[model samples]
Target: MATKKKPSSDQGSSSSALDSSRWEVSCFWERRLQKELMSLMKEPPPGVTVDAEGAGQNLTQWIIQMDGAQGTLYEGEQFQLQFKFSPKYPFDSPEVTFIGPNIPVHPHVYSNGHICLSILTEDWSPALSVQSVCLSIVSMLSSCKEKKRPPDNSFYVKTCNKNPKKTKWWYHDDSV
Candidate 1:
């Protein structure tokens, strides 16, 4: 006796099911970010340490930490970084911000804990990874010749109505 095989209903469904087997149900970007995180953990940036924990009530969001490198005002200090991964992912960078009470009060960072980095904005490229962002922050801190916060940090953070997204950053000066 010969057995009959079940016929697939739709091409899209069949293709999607096959794809789902390889990819996860979670947002594609989150998976990509997680993979990047794992790679970074294997070889983390210099002077900075990081970890990711599931956010309360939201598994998609991760809580990260950035320990101040040894030679900056942020040195020896511990800061919490929040990373909210959107469905767009590698095409769109994560929404990251420095949180926690001990957050740095730097020229480029706001009191509310937002960071002003070019790579996080217009300079962002799909070629960039989470590790690169952390490394950039590390380099930014190391290059700070003045240990004081930007004279306008408070003003900019408080008064600037422009969204971090709307304001394109110009990273011309490495001097912080």
Candidate 2:
């Protein structure tokens, strides 16, 4: 027997807010993302580069390029991460995933591009920023010893939620 999870009161209200003022809310987040993008362009972190995808008119989605850090199993390898931000950003974490043809095979990373990192889910805080998330991901890659998938890779990839942010991930392993 399985138990059903209850939706939080906050979720309900946020959904209502979205339904009521969808355009206004999206504009607010877009401006915020634009500001962050400008700041990032001025001073980006090492081994990480970000740009708006498509015609650069939308700030809601971005493409991030990351180079594997030295001394890691993925050294010299490059990867692309796609981040999709919702109108409730800062309050809601972005949907981040490895994109393109070269996805890294890491224990916490799914073949479908979903990453099981805690910060992107349960551990997410409104205080966390895009820059911080990039740093965290780079650090995760840096600490990995072996290039491989999680123990339940095949199963998880087959049945995992399309939106990783909706999944309830178990993050017991912190060894990376």
What is the TM-score of each predicted model, taking all chains together?
A: 0.72, 0.81
lDDT of 2 by residue, 1-176 (tens): 12243333332223345455434432455545655776677688998888744414566788889998887888899999998888788778999999999899888898888898999988889788789899999999888877898888899888878898878899998775
Deviation in Å, model 1, residue 169 alpha carbon: 3.8
Winner by lDDT: 2
lDDT of 1 by residue, 1-176 (tens): 12232334432223345355434223455345555655665677765455543442353566667777786766787777776666677777767678788767666777777778877877778888777877887777666655566556766677665446555555666554
- Badly placed stretches (over 4 Å) of model 1 are 1-21, 24-26, 55-59, 160-163, 166-172
lDDT (Cα atoms) of all candidates against the true structure? 0.64, 0.78
Model 2 Cα shift for residue 40 (angstroms): 1.2
Residue 59 Cα positional deviation in candidate 1, in Å, after optimal superposition: 5.3
Worst 10 residues of 1 by lDDT: 5-14
| Model 2 misplacement above 4 A | 1-26, 52-55
Candidate 2 local Cα displacement, residue 20, angstroms: 28
